[model samples]
Target: MPTVPSANPAEHLARTVDIVALLERGRAMSTPVLRAAVDRLAPPMNTVSSYHFGWIDAQGRPAEGDGGKAVRPALALLSAEAAGAAPEVGVPGAVAVELVHNFSLLHDDLMDGDEQRRHRDTVWKVHGPAQAILVGDALFALANELLLELGTVEAGRATRRLTTATRKLIDGQAQDISYEHRERVTVEECLEMEGNKTGALLACAASIGAVLGGADDRTADALERYGYHLGLAFQAVDDILGIWGDPESTGKQTWSDLRQRKKSLPVVAALAAGGPASHRLGELLAADVKSNDFESFSEEEFAARAALIEAAGGRDWTSEEARRQHAVAVETLDAVDMPEQVRAQLTALADFVVVRNR
Candidate 1:
């Protein structure tokens, strides 16, 4: 058995270095492909798409922004490397995954009524809802088009994988919307919803590179499992950040999730805890539901609810769960006999998922 590096204090610095380098490479490779693909769109659509990606401003001029972490694309490239293929072999898959991701983001922002993303106005807020929806549709179509341009066999498989993931993502979003209207939600249901909403795409991304690289089914399956668990961890951490993260770092209002009355993991966990704090939170949430006003929470009220969640052990439980999922993701890599370097990088990425501030 290849010895996996322990996620110990001594390994922290090295792991961070590996994660940063892998992410940088992913960004470098995926960005150009994404730009070229978006450039193929017609005038206003192209401008809207570019603005959504932080590539250009509303005036169709260049802008300065980090875009995003490019985590899914990085996973695709890394999976290809783990399958013993050159990173370039996965560029098409990486680009396809990223387009699908952004497509979902554009639609999600509209559905969720989000005003800001990455500390800037969302596409819908800036470009109008109709145009944003059209652009999202265009991006989704483009993802399929790009994947089909690959050789026949690979294109067919990747298209099937991506389509299935997209379906699950949509189903998850529907469920999430429904959950908000209900008075109660179980943790199990929330996990399942998150798996479909977030995990499906990440799983597809992790395996697409392997599929393109001609890796065996076993290797592809293992990487898919790795991504699924990583997705869960990522969502769990995101829930924590939703209520507690710095507005500047997270690129959203502080306690934004609570203000929206989102039934995220931490909130669900606290509701299930059944303590005094939980009871108080339930009352607050109930009042909000009765008022039908999600945007009414004052900063002080949001802070109080956050404190209640922490007092009820929601924060700790969610944090520990994120770490647990991260561990599972790392362990799944053991099933694939990749090069030590590739495994190390994958492990680092897993660590980064749980630890990222945004």
Candidate 2:
């Protein structure tokens, strides 16, 4: 595994702290507005959404720390700062983006049959999919309300971005679901699919930041491009990590994707390699074999499959892809008319994007 850039740790730590503080303030303004709108839409479920949002507990009691990492909002803020503006200029949009993201994740866990999230039982797992779906709806409504609360003028750029990104996310999810039954897929196509699914949102984060930062259309577009490429690179890295990452630290089982027969970037690349293990990967894909039977296969089976990915140049291909996208991210950051120190911080963050070993 490639070593994580030292810059990443530093930037992540600093950004995380700053973002957490920012969220603390944003929540105070945004949450009440969100709750009111949600209540207006689903008076019956108003209580449920409130509980899920961490306004209360299962018993409808008050609670804390119900909010998630708020990474999308953080990205929005960062994009604003990168463009030489105060981060909170994008506050409403940032909160909307985050709510939308969480909304998706809530439904995603239910659809994927996932039980855990953020170190706890997923909302669906605890509350059931029907309720979870309602919560998702609430999230969307809250997001839209947040956009509306930004007022006609303040909402112009941010709402446009949120709408575009939400569409991209739907398209990406459609493509991902379509891939489940697909037999023939290319690495390039997979990149496109994931780019829409994963890349669009990240792109939205940066784009919103720029738009709210009062950047010109050109600079905003550049920031959007940066987000798009970064999103792609991040997903590519995630696909790699999904297969090889340590279950203990990554909180994912080893070969989880293999077990699911997921045609992730590495798996597709291995199939394209056409070596001995490549042939086996083809056989497995063709025949629909199981990974729990991994021990039953040839002693060389696991190693051979991994070798096929390497031999077929899957890792290198992915690494190059990451580097390429990261270059775009840096390019966009550089193009922003921000202070040198601010730009440097963004650079450090760009490097951190694809430098993970996890």
Tens-digit lDDT string for candidate 1 (1-358): 0122466432444354667778889989988998999999997999999999998886778998658988988999988898999998888889999998989999989998889999889999998999989999999999999989886786787788889999999999988888887767899999999999999999988889888888877888899999999899989988899899999898998888887778888888999999799999888877777788755557898899899998988898899888888888888887888887777777778777888889
TM-score, cand. 1: 0.95
Q: What lDDT, from 0 to 1, does candidate 1 have?
A: 0.86
Global lDDT of each candidate = 0.86, 0.68
Give the lDDT of residue 175 in candidate 2. 78
Give per-residue CA lDDT, model 2, range 223-303, as digits (tens): 788788888878778787767766654555556555445677887777776777677667756655433344455535555
Model 1 shows how many backbone clashes? Answer: 0
TM-scores for every predicted model: 0.95, 0.80
